[model samples]
Target: MTSLELQRTNLPEGLEELLGPKGLLTGEEAREYGRDFMGEVDNAPLAVLRPETTEQVAEALRLCTEHGLSVIPQGGRTGLTGAGVPSRPDHEVILCLARMNKVRWLDEKNHAMAVDAGCILADVQKAAADANRLFPLSYGAEGSCQIGGSISTNAGGTAVLRYGNTRDLILGLEVVLADGTVLDMMRALRKDNTGIDLKQLFIGSEGILGVVTGAVLKLYPAVAERECALLAFPSLPAVMKSFAIARESTNDRLSAFEMMPQNGITLACNRVPDVVDPVEGDYPWYALLEVSASKEGSGLFEMLEGLIERLMEEGLVVDGTVSSNEGQRAQLWRIREALVEAHNDMPHLLKHDVSVPISDMADFIETAIEKVQAIAPDAMLIAFGHVGDGNVHFNICHDLDTPDGSLATRHKEVTWAVYDLVQEYRGSFSAEHGVGSMKRDALRRYRSEAELAVMEKLKTALDPQGLLNPGKVI
Candidate 1:
């Protein structure tokens, strides 16, 4: 038998025997894991290894490395970037941690929890809630996105303004290196003045450094009261003005300040079922404000009301509505979630997850819109996201009346225009989505030579073979 054919045959056989039939999958059964959450990448791997323990993962990595095969470590596969799936068909093996879903322990006193990397983010949040604590890392994909993927991307969600990103919420990590070395740093302590902080290296590395097997996550006090408001603005400046006023007036109680455009809200109300706009009339922009406190009778509702009243009188807020109960609050937040869902099926959509300084967000959006319009005059800009943290999901939808492939042809030009504008404003082209295979070019173009050199040196130091999640990040 040929060496290539023999290697392929023997690799699967060894994996099957080591991991058993249930743990290893090939052929059509493995195709589903090959695709990402957005169905953007559909290249099937040579084999899918579902390891339930760290020891199994270590052994699997050793076997794959010996065979000169590349391995891609995947969690829930809910990432927008093509980081979790195979970049090429039958050339790489996917090491998925779905079967390792388990909550190891929860310490209420320490306000910490230890969980297997495959545990769903929602499950972790529920466990923390059950312990009378809060896991503040939240987004729409919490239902299916894994904790490991969240950490790997250093995910930032709505609550990042108050609680910070997944990086801040993590106390420790348990990682398996490319050469089968297990770096178990899963300590639950809040303060460990250890050198180097090895966990930070892998947090946002996107699996190129190592496979995150588990984590010890920090938690906060459970929220006892929350106030939600949907405010309308005549322009982007007005939105920022209201945000500044809300932030200072709330006395650091602002947990979320998401911005949504009129067109985005319209699309959500039209495309997504059961999603209705809270504001009666159409304004140029909208902001979804949320404030939460741990203790009851915190007067957050009164605070929100007073802030809105002052903003309305100041003409910063043209129209607004505050949620009186949980149902109303959910309905208001549904508009934000549905806006994202509205663009899922657009074939030629240009999605930009960029971030700028809070002070420059207004100018950045306005300038980006101008730049995009210059490229594609008919393009619809659906700008929305966690404006509190300055991350905007600046997406452009194709003009439906135009030819089918016209927008696809200009995708690169439009993306570069937006990215160039982001760079000009000292903003990041890839804010929260990560630099998977999709944004690697932007990473190269935007990052300085010094920055890239440090990244490459670290990658070489940890994963010399470049086998871990190949073709991603650096």
Candidate 2:
């Protein structure tokens, strides 16, 4: 037998029987779980373990630990980072929680819901909506991304301006340590001042510390009224100024304030079907503003109209359009989604999910654009993101007509220039995306030695064997 076949056959004895045939996947079936959502890392694992319950996960971990095998905990595998896949071929096993998908309970009175880590984010949102509550953690991948993976990455979507990141939405977690010890800290209370917040450790740890089996997520009152507007800005400064005025005048109803560049909108309108620019005139920048209220008849539509008129009069907004209904609102939002889809297949695209202080957003973008132009003048910059939270998806790629491999040589140089500027502004290199194997170098380069030491100490304390998602995060 070949070495890979030998390794596959050496899987922890009785594992197949313990998990049954359907739960333990090998050969071609196992390779399907080896890659990430981005198809960036495609290392085949020895086996793929699909556990149906928390106990099954714990027992599997115990067996894997006994056999001195490393385990990679995976969720919906919709993460842009390579955190949910095996990093080495035939050297590890994937412990996918997809089969444990279940909505355990929902407490409308308490404004909380218990769910299996494998539960789809959209399903959880629907469950909360059925209870007349709102689970506002939303994004493009909500249709496929699992709740556990969102928690693991501390995902920040467009709604982060009003709600918060996934870390804030989670009230409790149920984690299985490397050695199979179950830490059940699944409390739904909002105010728990008991000792240390143990769940926080694994929130953005990316499965390096442990595997999350379940979660208790916080919910909010359902939005009764909402108003959306697509506003055009003559300059980046105008966009930021309008954002400030809108936030202050909206009576705390401003849920989303997203910034989209002209290039991104143009690409979306040209490439994505039914995704057209909402406003006339070729403005340099655009902002998608959404205001929502829990109380019915909150006059949000009138409020947004008045806000737009004032901004226009002040020259902060050059052109604008408001959504009169849900369909119109969805059409406006489609521009943002379409921008992402438009360039997904582009060659040698370098995506940077970095965040800086909100005050320095416009200046950072302007200066970064200049620096990037200096590196590759022909590169197309598709910079857009949640301006309210200061997270910029500063993606760069070669011009459409350029050759496929043109930007391959300067990819590292372009990325380092952007990240170095982020560091100078006291910003995070990897903001919403966790430090997977891809960003391990950035983590080491950006983080201080003392900070890394503490992280290493925690990893040693929790996963001393270093057999849980090895070569990831720290």
Per-candidate local distance difference test? 0.90, 0.92
Candidate 1 TM-score versus the reference: 0.97
Best by TM-score: 2
TM-score, per-candidate, Cα-based: 0.97, 0.98
lDDT of 2 by residue, 118-188 (tens): 99999999999999999999999999989999999999998999999999999999999989999999999
Model 1 misplaced regions, further than 4 Å: 1-13, 401-408
Model 2 steric clash total: 0
Q: Which lDDT tens digits does candidate 1 get at residues 345-393? A: 7668888999999999999999889888887777788899998898999
Clashing pairs for model 2 are none
Task: Report the CA-based lDDT of candidate 2 relative to the real structure.
Answer: 0.92
